[model samples]
Target: MTNINTEVVLRKLLDNIAKEHNYNDPNVSVRAITTDGASYSSMLYAATISTPNKEELQLFAKVANVGEIARSQLLLPLFDIERFAYKELLPAYEKIQDRNKLSNKDRLVWPKFYGCNPNLYEETVVLENLKTKGYVAYDRLKSIDWAYASKAVESLAKFHALSIAYGEENPTQYAELLAKMKFNPDSLNKMAGTFDKLVDMAVAVTKEDNKERLRQYILKESGFKNIDKFYQSTGLIILSHGDYKPSNLMHKTNKDGSIDVIPVDYQTISANSPIKDLYYLIFTGSDEEFRRHHYEQLIDHYYQQLCRALRNLNLDPEKHYPKKNYEKDLKDFMPFGLVLGVLALPVITVEAENAPSLQDENGLNSILTTKTSNLYPERLNGIVNDYVRWGIL
Candidate 1:
């Protein structure tokens, strides 16, 4: 965007923030702040809005991805989903927490929305900048440690709890939101060919005898083709952060030696089995070694946190999501971990230089062809080995 157009948008955003917070005579300064290889779909910026009295407000804005490849990948609808999340879904969640008198620590925390313009290719969503408050994105190249993973799941559980409350408290509105947020399966199916190529590449490196079984499962039985049916199967359904990996979360260490995590990037948000979110976080964010040591523990921690969060909101866990049902869902969705791990590891582990620019027709194809770090194969082998050990392959 030109400087003139950028200034106009920034002024409009600051004016909206002023209207909400009663700022007078605000002056705005903008700067690009996106991390290298941090986001694939949008440009990120940090801005400061100052008043004559010297009061300042820090803000973040996500500009829509502009390219034929990006649009073909359904970036526009994804932006719509994110805007709906900030403008509609999160506000309702906050109201539910406020009505229940939930503590701040127990509530679902997210960036404070300023405003948005959903005008076609000019799409933009603005919100309070958490980075100014010491929050930082986790390094994508590294596996998540237990401390970070635990806090992340805690935050995720609280979010799912609030989603459950929203559905129970306002069934009609919740249904409408679900209808709107249900992502296009065709958009996902577009990547099926890419994953098919990924599967062959994965199998070529497989050392285990059961590698053929892995191929059969992913290609014939458990690929993206079956995702809709799998998610629609009998399970506790809620609004899920569809891309719940480390890169999409921002964290800060507290004085008490605990990490506070907040999830961002709701562009891929959808309504589905809550287990799908858990699988995404674990498979996409952690390696086999981390899973071997803490996988079951993380699952238990998430459930425990979910129960607590639900109780804080005056909901009964046994009535809504019992342990037996959760256990059953885990067994039913077990293959999802392997499938998602194989597909996401490549994208997540690609070096910055090899990352897709999203500026050309072949941008999305870079997901299949990018040169990834050795971590990719090591992690892929780990996931396959785990499945083999568990006899799931």
Candidate 2:
């Protein structure tokens, strides 16, 4: 067993792997290591390792603990799903590569996964560095463009297709595994107050008629009381990138002037309606005019690509993810767009440094804070107008 407290042991572990991978230069320097969040029972590091040609490769290393917070507080009690994403999820993800029947590859499109090892203290996963690839991070909600949106929609379709294909081919396994999966409503509930605040902002920015309409809809349709019911009844469960926001997607421009969307941070992977991802992406990322102009086209585009992907995976889109089912799911789950907009708009529309931190309880409550004056008037007005125009209010 290696000691967790000793930096030497950790460095040695990284160094040995560097050498084995033909990384030369004989000297390995650990540049920066830091925890990604308080909720995870893991450690993430931004490391620079010497490569064969004496070049430094920036990599991310993830180590899994005995159990993660989600597993303990959410997954175990709800779905009996285990924690330790690096140990559990990574293996399943890697198996997709091993099968070779799918088009998933690590180096070109996806983040490359290096070999994993288990020590007495913890398990470790080494990943190919992404920083050297010129990946840029931008807030999805605020940074919407044709190139970004198109790429994102296409990539998401592929991801959803993979899940549908896997589920169809392995029905028994899919059902069994998903049965243990549970949604942590606690997190949603925790953010309820923030949502309320967002609604109040929306109300203020809207015209009197629209505001009343929104108020009625908020009370009757999208309230916290009925949100869970919507999720439960929606028969559109697929492996959703739970956190399908712009920040989680990385982008790099190719020589041809096209942008590629690379999905990272799979920790929030869950069985949810694909529309949930769509709702989150569009509501948070796109502006009112863009959404108003392209909403129908975008929705149709997403479904079309999703169906194409499902077909590519040899899965019948009609049987599992038909248009009828998608429409029904949208009717029930699309309210999340409004609901999350109320809660997310303040933060999503604000300057990064000025936005409330998720780490603070006060900031958390501010998410539900009913004060509209603190938000950007233009954005809030736009959101209210769009909801009204869509008849969602």
Candidate 3:
């Protein structure tokens, strides 16, 4: 969007906030507006504004991409997913917590949603500017240490547990929001086709043995079936943050070196198995050794926290979400991580210079093309080795 267009959006955002808060101050105005970056898909703006009391309010706003809304007919409605999350799901989670009597410090941590505008497929969500609060994303190029990884697992468990508690309370309403959202099968097929091209490109660079292995594992007709199956898997379904990679999570280090994890970008949430999000976070953020040592431990920690969360909500975890059942689902869903890695690692490892332009209308194909980063092949090899060790092949 041009500078003028951005200013117009900010004006609309201010109006939305004022209307929501019932503030009718004529003097309230945006004094300054600065964009975060253009490389990211969302158009992010940081605004400094004067409120009715002459108080300064610093806010962060994420405006959905106009390109995706215009070109991709299937993705046009995807914006509503995030808006629904902030508007509906988050509030519901908090209500459950309030009933459970969780302390303010123990509550789920996320950006405070001021309000939203989902008009004409141009979704705009106004939220807290966590940057001013000392939150930032971990460096994607580096592996996460145990301190951060443990916190992440525990944090994710808390979020997923809310799903179970919510489902128990409103069994029929667990997936109510997602039931109304659209998921085009054509987009899934197109996504598979794009991954096929990516694997073919990767085959040229892979070792002979590993090349055919990846091809047979990822390029066969079953590849599409597996992808479809993941999308359809609803067993033990609950609300999930669809994209749980490091870039989507924020953290901070205090003077004592303790860390805080706060999640952002609720766009990919679904009423699917919670393991999907955990798998995405592990595969995309960590390496083989990290998983080799901590994978089982992390999984255990997640379930423990899940039980605690269920109890906090006054539900029996053993009955609502059993440990044996959760373990079985984790194992059954492990292969899906490989499928996700094939699609995610490429985008994750792509250097800025080689990264695809968002201007490209071809969607995932634009980002799935061959990469110049040697890290890509190393990461791919590690993931393949993991699948083999886990006997997931």
Best by TM-score: 1
Measured by TM-score, how close is model 3 to the native structure?
A: 0.88
Could you arrange the candidates by TM-score from highest to lowest?
1, 3, 2
| lDDT per model vs. reference | 0.82, 0.63, 0.71
Distance (Å) between predicted and true CA of 271, model 3?
A: 1.6
lDDT at 190 for candidate 3? Answer: 44
Query: Which candidate do you rate higher for TM-score, 2 or 3?
Result: 3
- 1-393 in candidate 1: lDDT tens per residue? 321254456567667777777777667778876566768777778888887775688899877665666577652367888888998888988899999998777877999898897776667888989988999999988899999999999999999999999999999988987776665566677777787888887887677686788888887668768765655656877888888999999999999999999999998788788899988999888888899999999999999999999999999999999999999999999988877766777778777777776656775776776777787888888889889888878
lDDT of 2: 0.63
lDDT of 2 by residue, 1-393 (tens): 222643444476677777777776556665545332221334556666765566665676655533332233332221112233444554554464346465542211557765454553455556766767888666533547777887788888878777776676678987865654546565566556645666676677766667788788887988877777545555877767766777667888889998878876666667777888887888777778788777788888889988876666667888878898888887777678777666666655555344433223343453443233333566556767876676666
Our model 2 lands, by Cα RMSD against the true structure, at 5.5
Clashing pairs in 3: none
TM-score of 2: 0.76
Model 3 regions lying over 4 Å from their true place: 1-4, 15-40, 51-54, 66-76, 181-186, 220-222, 369-372
Candidate order by lDDT, decreasing, is: 1, 3, 2
